[model samples]
Target: MRFEKENWDVIIVGTGPAGACLAREISKQHKKVLLLEKGQADLSINIPRMLKNNEMMFIGNGKTLVRGIRSGGTSVLYYGTAYDPPEELFSKFGIDLASEVEELRRELPLAPLKDELIGPAAQKIRESAVSLGYAWEKLDKFIYQDMCTPGYFPFDAQWNATRYVNDAINSGAVLLTNSEVTKVIVNGKQAVGVEAIVQGERHKLFASQIVLSAGGLGTAQILQASKINKAGEGFFCDPITIVQGLAEGIEAGNEIPMAAGMMFKNEGFILTDLTLPKLVYQLFSFQALRPHRVWQHRRTIGIMVKVRDGIGGSIKRGKVHKVFSEADKLKMQQGESKAREILQHAGAKRLYSTVWTSAHPGGTARIGEVVDPNLKSEYDNLYVCDCSVIPTEWGLPPTLAVLALAKRLAKHLLLRSYHRR
Candidate 1:
């Protein structure tokens, strides 16, 4: 059978934040770039109906998580909470994030949710944190204020990757959806192209530079399939546990935002609010069918904690092997106790824990371990720009860090092109 061969100046896999950002930067310089995704492109997937119906389950490494698999990737399912990358953490990895911060401020909306928008449950939590004299603050999220209504929640304010992907496309970058890259074609330890499955047929795409933004798991899978197993070593995720609280005089509704405030305790753990769909409450709340008097007290809040994980994990064949160390477990327990304390102060009547919940999973391809400081893999012309490249367990979410790295890598790639000329 005959196959078609296409050449591009650059080919990026995954249309998430990193890929979309890189594509946008490169395309502005007039580079012929192709962005490939394993899912379909749809912005409206953020709508409640779409998200609930097409939720994909990812289970491995002793945890089960759900996320959207469409064109915008997991952004469609993300709670849209935008957190600033811890500057000190990136500096340790030899990354300068100052300029990235400036760019982010210019491009994205970052502010605390207004008082009117904060639900009664969240306000009580905040008040408790203040009373405890803990260092806490409202979290800024990427959201469109205009779209928010009294009873309607706008989950898209967080900088969804779809916007960046669309910007890249508008800037002249070609996008290929429903294309799964199966292998990286290498010659003499240098990657020159990729082999992908599109419409049940095999096709090849060549590029001068290849960037893997295929996310933590997808990046590891692609690297492993290409006989590059070291990329899967040292994988780390901020193993999180959600503690839910039942409050009095509160109803089970979607008015509450996903993330509102955060408390960073001295015990090296962080606690924040957690919101879920109404269906989630119906399934988890023990008193779901109580009378209006009892149901009025069905307020639920979430506390997410990040443990100090000394033992790094691994990902093999789409399986995540995360065995918590003694220290990690201890940290989680400590965080849980603190969360209970906060709930008690906030007048929580009952508390329950979720089965499995964690948003950020990073370090699958750590810097200086799997990929070099420049994010280039041991294989030539192959690079990674995603949360997978984080070197250690960041106590906070990693979207901002991933974007900073992508911006820096784009500059590096551009300089290389100039030098070659």
Candidate 2:
């Protein structure tokens, strides 16, 4: 592979926020970079279309968890929700991202949504939560308001990693889609390169630096497959469920989903109003055995509750062997109850819940335990800069935090390259 040449400085094994940001940043230094994505490069930013086509979305193990597998990774499916990282968490890794975080906030379109963008369902949810004494508020997002309309587009208004991928490509970085990395090629505790499968063929690519940003589960699966035996253990997947109800006199065809929510930090959960597109709404409604509610798609309002689960699981053959504990069940129950109450207060009836599923999964390869503070593993030049590096439970969206953290990792990689040269 061309990456085997001495001119190739780095190879990133993902197109998600971490890898995308890193490639874009490193390419600015005129370094030869290679970005590999396991999925296709076709942009499937239209939510309704992707839902109908049943492509780009990967739901494994009876819908236990779902993720987007595409050039932009899950960010293509994301609603751009933003949150400040628990800086203290990275402090344990002896890294401070205050400046990086601030820089990204300025660079990206992170802001609280305007009132016009807040759907009626979200307003009702916020009012109910406030009346119930919960501090409900609008969440910031990485949205370009100028391009953001209610409907979805192929290259929707979302601030996806694809933009960064494009920038990297324009800066002379090479990107290969549909190249699934199977393992990192290690030479006696030193990562010299990686081996991947492309179109059912094997290929070897050598690089001075190898950065793994293939998400949490994706990264863990790769590590375990690479003979890093302990890499897949001790993972968590914020066990979650969506409490939904049919609200009378509410129409949400053009409503932006996930705009407002109540963060019950101490209560160990969050409640967000999940507005849905009509087609997507009907599918969930039918599968939930509420086929009778299918026609009322525009009137459906949902509240999603996600709680931190104990990190204890193993990933084998790309499947997560994890289950909800008794304590996790209790937290789910508590959160579901609150969500139902808010829906009821908002004049919603015929309440129901989707089976528990995880949106974010992480902590598989931790900072202090599995990797060092520099995000380097037990092996040399093998770094991990994704959710897998998160050492503890995190209840928020990780896109923003991952992008900032990648900047820190990119700085380290660049400095190391300089010293070596």
Q: Rate the local accuracy (lDDT) of all candidates.
A: 0.72, 0.81
Q: Please report, as a residue range, the 10-residue window in candidate 2 with the lowest summed lDDT.
A: 52-61
lDDT per residue (tens digit) for residues 1-421 in model 1: 2223556888999988788889999999998889988777766534355445334334454454444456666676666666667777667768787898679778876667777777666677778877997655777776775667655676564568888888888988988887888878898889999988865677888888999988877888899998887877865556667677777676535665544555453455677766556655444343333333234334666565655455366777766666667777788888888888888888876666554444556677888788888999989999999888888766566676677788889999999888878
RMSD in Å for all candidates: 3.6, 2.6
How does candidate 1 fare on TM-score? 0.89
Over the stretch 1-421, how does candidate 2's per-residue lDDT look in tens digits? Answer: 5444444689899998889999999999989899988888866456555554333233444555656667888787777888888878788667898999998988898897787777778888988988988878899978887775444322456688999999999999999888889999999999988888865678888888999989888898888877877787877777667888878787765677788887777767777888766666776666677788888777778898888777876777865677667887788899999999999998898899977667667888888888888899988999999888988877778888889889999999999999997
- Residue 226 alpha-carbon offset, candidate 1, angstroms: 1.9
TM per candidate: 0.89, 0.93
Flag regions of model 1 displaced more than 4 Å.
1-4, 42-62, 256-259, 263-266, 283-298, 306-311
C-alpha lDDT of candidate 1 relative to the true structure:
0.72
The best candidate by TM-score is 2
